[model samples]
Target: MIRTSLASAPLRVLAADATPVFREGLRAVIDRTVGLEWAGGTDHADAIRRGVRTIGPRVVVLDSAVDPTCTLIRDLVEINPELMVAVLFRDHDRSPASVRVAQSSGARCLLSRDTEASVMVRALLQAHQTGRYVDPRLTMVLSRPWQSASACDAGVLLTARQRQILALVAQGMSEPDIARHLDLGAATVSSHMKETRRRLGARDRAHAVALAYHVGVLPLRPALVAQRGISPVRPAHTD
Candidate 1:
């Protein structure tokens, strides 16, 4: 319903950035661009979630500097499923791994910090209309194939419903909250969760979450930066 009305309106674009220059520049550019309006800028990821729900922006331009770990995109998407996130990556951070990290964190579009003003504006419009836009300069990076090392990247796939439910679980949402959020009955949500746990070979909800992070099916919470890449499970062979 929110997105349906935004189709004919000037879709609002919020900046999940704290930098003065970047936010001001984007605001100025968006003000002049047709079919796009500047919603506002958020200094931290916490405020981003609030703005996303209250402001109802169709797209969010998140600066990598503000969210270096790229964890906020997934949470924002959970708040508004229709939202599109475009990460503003640093020029030096152009690599196949970096692209995959951003995509895995739920960013649908990528833009370089040094990208031309005109190109950035074009990308925003493209994301709003078509739901994606990658920086043309990064096209070569995509040519390299991704190596599958984790279960998530291997053959393991989660159904859309399972992924959504698991995401809510990752945020520490209770089953009832998830049910209300997704408009599913509590029992239905529980059933999907049980299946997800079984698929991951998790013993419980907490175990399911840990395995989800291990498999790259979920991104690490920003607070757990120091623990990044450290699996919670110890290999049986280690014994």
Candidate 2:
């Protein structure tokens, strides 16, 4: 099993959700978990912003329904680029659209509302340390092969490492996280990201991920599942 070396420091985390019940329960959960601390909790996006600034937690876990847009997530990241973010989603609400939204919004980890407290804490700690978390179910999603541009297709040419980085980006790891995972420098990751945006005619990282998905370079995990044994889904616009 893949594992990250444990950090000597306990991870500090901030929790944000409009629901009082969820916030309290999550706080309790994290307090009981090892190597994690519940810095504070908030009920509004503005309050979350304020709390994160005040406490300077290593990670912030937000309720997905509370902030569904990419703009809001990006704003939070801009508030503190070093803060790792996780989104709390409902199990009944899992869908391709939701997954896409979560990725576009810069959430490195996702926890189902039905998830156990222990699981939630574990996920939070993972994000705090590695900048990415994949629950057993989501891990399956992450492992699916991303679509590559067609052999004859000409606009963008991505090297093998670039393609791997694209997949990690689609999985919502920040530039530094990608650098850490790939053992490359942050500057190198930034360079590859810039090239991806330029080659795919994308405006930003989220846009690049969307373009990759739409153009068939990264097929939704379920879509690929349904096609079992058939010819692989071609990258978009290949024909």
Give the top-scoring candidate (lDDT).
1
TM-score of 1: 0.59
Off by over 4 Å in 1: 1-7, 145-239
Query: How would you encode candidate 2's per-residue C-alpha lDDT over 176-225 as one tens digit per residue?
Result: 99999999999999999998776554557776765555444555566533
**Model 1 lDDT per residue over 141-207, tens place:** 6554432333325234467788889989988999999999989999999999999876654557765
RMSD of 1: 14.7
Write down the RMSD of all candidates, one decimal each: 14.7, 16.0
Q: List the residue pairs that clash in candidate 1.
A: none
The segments of candidate 2 whose C-alpha lies over 4 angstroms from its true place after superposition are: 1-7, 139-239
